[model samples]
Target: MTNFQQSEALSRVQPSTTLAVTQKARELKAAGRDIISLGAGEPDFDTPDFIKDAAIQAIRDGKTKYTAVDGIPELKQAVATKFKRDNNLDYDLDQISIAPGGKAILYNALVATMNPGDEVIIPAPYWVSYPDMALLAGGKPVIVKADASNGFKLSPEALEAVITPKTKWLIFNSPSNPTGAAYTHNEIKALTDVLLRYPHVMVMSDDMYEHIVYDGFEFATPAEVEPALYDRTLTVNGASKAFAMTGWRIGFAGGPKPMIKAMAKVMSQSTSNPSSISQWASVAALNGDQSFLKERNDAFKERRDLVVSMLNQANGLTCATPEGAFYVYPSCEGVIGKATPNGVKISSDEDFAAALLEDEGVAIVFGAAFGLSPYFRVSYAAAIEQLEDACQRIQRFCASLT
Candidate 1:
């Protein structure tokens, strides 16, 4: 037998808990157990027909060849137009970089910029990959816990408290994953104001869920809110969540020309370019009709309401109505220290999640997986019927806790 060892960089990263829970649910269902999974951070809707048609047309046009290292010119132009039109931010084609996915885009930026011992500030509960990516890039992850009282948003004071001379980047996400808590323009301005004092710290704003806001919540990014930070901000968006094109693997960003070039250099040595067909499809997605987005937002809002209502009805769960995205992070503090019907003690969010899955076959990601605790995330991106059934099962599981 040969002895194999993982690299130190790989050892520091944890497997994605969301994907693990989703897969476990699949395995259980395959074995004839009834399962309701609310763990994936993907939209249940299909990519619009117009976008698919563009991809088909591209294939017929033989646009399947490898493209520029970062992206094709047409797609870059489309992305530039999108930034100007939707975000009120301007970017030249040379200032943009496209990669296989949003994750890849962020990873490339970190790898291109981070040095050993550099600090990356992250707010929790954050996306599962932020800290791990920083660690993989040889940067220390400085996690600042966001308070639940303020809708899981980081405060300006909290932001200031974590700043050190060695800080390199602050990874910000609006319409956040897991919690779906979007900051208002004033809230963003407050944080950007703090960032203005720390000129050494760059901002990587993930606006992946920009179009998924509810109740007319206007989305704003750091650079859009604070022009002073525009030169230091990398505004990242993609054709995944809002566009229902996750499998398309298209993500992009617009930033300073030098940073953009560096990210492209990193991509050149790794995944050279995003899929050519997907790039063309994304062009059409950005330039084509955007009316379908409103329709999808309406549907997501309804599902969010249903999940929030039913989860709050659960005996030991308290869910807050998020401003955007398809996820709801609910505190499971009420179930802690309680024993399951089978005498399994729920000492933590992980235990509660495990017991719920074992007893009711409802799968959800535990909050500790996202750098928070005594809470769990429920993605309302599933069908409304499935969400209702999952919520009911969660309620039953909570009630069964003695």
Candidate 2:
């Protein structure tokens, strides 16, 4: 085999630990064993019929040709309208950039804006891709821990402590990946209050799960809550979680005109505008009536309740009732240092996950992968029956430990 010298930027990167367990679960499932997975990050629901019909119509109308580098005017207009109607923040067409997905849009922004040695502040238990993307873009990721004690919400004091002259971006995700933690309007305003003190620090708010909230919790964004930061904030969102369109490969963001132009420039050379058909479908998602969102969200809330309650009932597991998203980050501290019935020692969340997967065919991601410890993230994206079955297996596995 020929030895190759990878780029310095790539040398600093690591494969997504989250996807590693997910792939392991897939391998087991492919082998014909019954595996109930709680590792998924996306909604289990199918893409709405209206959005699918729009894609079909786009294909039939021969709109498959290459389009603009930034985004088609029609889709951008729809996104603008979405921001106005949902977040009450008005964005013009020129202020938006569309990409293959939320992750791609975020990477594009980092690549387009980050200079070498720039520091991007990221909270711990963040999405697996954020720090890696920043490193790939030649920026430094300065992580600040957000403990479970605070419901995984970042405090203004923590935000203030991290800012420096080199600080360039603050990456924020609401209804977060592993924790399903949503920041209230007041909590966000508190952080934004600190942000006002640092003019050099810009914000990238990832609102991918904005519609999956529960307990009458309304969603809020940086631009909407703190209008002053609106000029520097990149509000990124997509239909992947909200409209169950993960495979559609469409995500969009709105920000300052200069930042939007830089991001579009990167997109122009790289993955020129998102897929034409996907963009058309996104337009339908944004402009169409959103009554279906509530129905899907109700289903998600029910599943969340079922999974969270069942997991809490499991021995050695204490799950916090997440107010949004379809995930439960449960503390497994009680099981640590315990020995399995099979004589293997469960010293960490990873060990517990492996044992559970092998013994009970229940797949879960360890919380250490998300930068926390003694915890595991359980996705309730499966059906009610499957979720119940997984929880039963989990309880049994928990009981197997002594």
Candidate 3:
């Protein structure tokens, strides 16, 4: 027998529960169980033909060699143009760094700057990766709980209360994962006012879902909302969510030159540049026509409304209507303390999710995995028919609970 010990760094972070549940759904479906999965954080659409053609053309043109460590000059320029055209922020090529994905971009920033005992303020109901990334970087995650009452948003008061001498970064996401709650311009400015007082705290504005917003919701980033914080804010965006290019693995960000340089240094040591083909595809993605975005967003909006309406009808589930994104976070407190048909008691959010999965074969990520409990997150990124079936099963499961 051999004793194998994992590194402390490896032990600090848990496997992504979103991916875990998604994998479980796949396993069950493969085992002959009828499963409807609302667990993946990816869009259910295919990458547009234009982007795919770009990759094919790149391969045909022999553009498959390694380029710059951070990114190709063209992609960086595209990203810079995108910032100016979309976000009203001017960024030079040197201030931009590209990574394999938005998650990689975030991890690189944290790893490059974090020291032991550093703190990152992550709003609750955040994307599952935020806190774990902080932990992996040898920093403490200071979670600020922002529930339904606060529209799942961190208030200025809450933001001010959490800051300390050790606070290094504030990981901010709009149209957030799990909750799909996006902050208004005024809302973001309120928090930025607090950050202006704290010179040491930097901001990582994850705007990956910027184009997927709905109902004419104007998306605003922290740096865009407050120019005073631009020097310390890293505006991160990618083609994964918006362009339905998850497999492309292209994420880019603009920040201070020093921070961008440091992040590139980390990338140079790890996964150098993103795939050359993917980079070329991403260039087309960033620079090509964006007419398809609204069509996709319109589809997402319809699915979001359907899920919200149907989930609200489920007994004991109180769902909030989000302004953007393809997810709905519903409180499962009504289902807690109940029992399944097999007499399994549902106590925690995880328990409610497990019982639902076992009885109805509909998979969702439990809210506790997002730093909130007595709730669960449902991604409505599935097809209309699948969402209809999953919600029907959820209604049936709720009806059967004692």
Candidate 4:
């Protein structure tokens, strides 16, 4: 018998809870269970046809061979244009990095820059990957809990209190995963103001859901709000959420030349360039007519409202309507300490989630998995009818708890 031990770095991180929950739902559905999964953060929309055409054209043009380790020149130029047009930010070709996906882009940046004992500040309830990724890169994760009272957004005072001399990075996300809370321009400016005091902390702004705002809500990024922090900020966006291109696996970042070069070097040694076909498709995604975004956003807003309203009606659940993204974080505190019809005690969010899945066949990610508690996240990215059914099931389950 051979004893195999996990590496110290690999052992430090847990699997992504979101992906795990999504997979569990898939398994349950495959086993003949009628499961309505709201665990995935992916959009329910299909990738636009024009973008798909570009990928097909690329294949016909024999663009299958590997090119630059980071990105192709055409895609880089397109990304540059996107930054200028959408974000009012400027970046030269050398200051851009393209990777397999947004997750890869972020992980590459962390691997390129993180040193042992360096601190990466992340706000809770954050995307599940942030803290784990930091731990994997030999960096310490410093989590700051953003309260629901403030719409689950990080306050400048709270952010200022968490900063220490060893802090090297702040992983910031707007239209955040798990919570879907987007910050206004002035709100972001307040946090950027605090960052101005700390020259050493780099900002990794995940603007993956930049175009998913609702109700005339304007989206703002750290670099866009504060020009002084531009050099230290990596503005990351991808075709996943807004463009419904999750399977395309294309993510790009614009930042300081040194950071970009470092990320490219990391890519060169690891995944090399992203899929050549995907890169071409992303160029079209960035440069093509964006009229479809408005239509899709209108649909997302409807689903958001429906889910929020229905969840609020649940006996023990109170869901907050988010500014953007497709998730609703509902506090299940009222259900905690209660007993299910099966007599199982719902002492925590995890218990509540498991019980809901077992009893009602509705899958949702629990808050503790996202560094918060007494709450759970429901992704309303499904079809409206499915969302209605899931919400109804959730209400029935909540009402049954006593």
Per-model CA lDDT versus the true structure? 0.94, 0.90, 0.94, 0.95
Which lDDT tens digits does candidate 3 get at residues 1-402?
389998898799999999999999999999999999999999999999999999999999999998899999999999999999999999999999999999999999999999999999999988999999999999999999988889999989999999999999999999899899999999999999999999999999999899988889999999999999999999999989999999889999999999999999999999998999999999999899999999999999999999999999999999999988888999999989999889999999999888888999999999999998888999999999999999999999999999
lDDT of 3: 0.94
The lDDT, on a scale of 0 to 1, for candidate 4 is 0.95
Candidate 1: where is the Cα deviation over 4 Å?
none
Pairwise TM-score winner, candidates 2 and 3: 3
Cα lDDT for residue 395, model 3?
A: 95
TM-score for predicted model 3 compared with the true structure: 0.99
Relative to the unseen true structure, what is the C-alpha lDDT of residue 310 in candidate 2, on a scale of 0 to 100? 88
TM-score of each: 0.99, 0.98, 0.99, 0.99
lDDT of 1 by residue, 1-402 (tens): 389998999999998888999999999999999998888989999999999999999999999998999999999999999999999999999999999999999999999999999999999999999999999999999999995988899999999999999999999999999799999999999999999998999999999999999998999999999999999999999999979999999999999999999999999998999999999999999999999999999999899999999998999889889999999999999989999989999999999889999999998999999989999999988888888888888888899889
RMSD of each: 0.8, 1.1, 0.8, 0.8
Model 1 vs. true fold: TM: 0.99
Predicted candidate 4 versus true structure: per-residue lDDT over 125-196, tens digit per residue: 999999999999899999999979899999999999999999999999998998989999999999999999
lDDT, candidate 2, 107-187, per-residue tens: 999999999999999998888888899999999999999988899888888889989999999999998987899999999
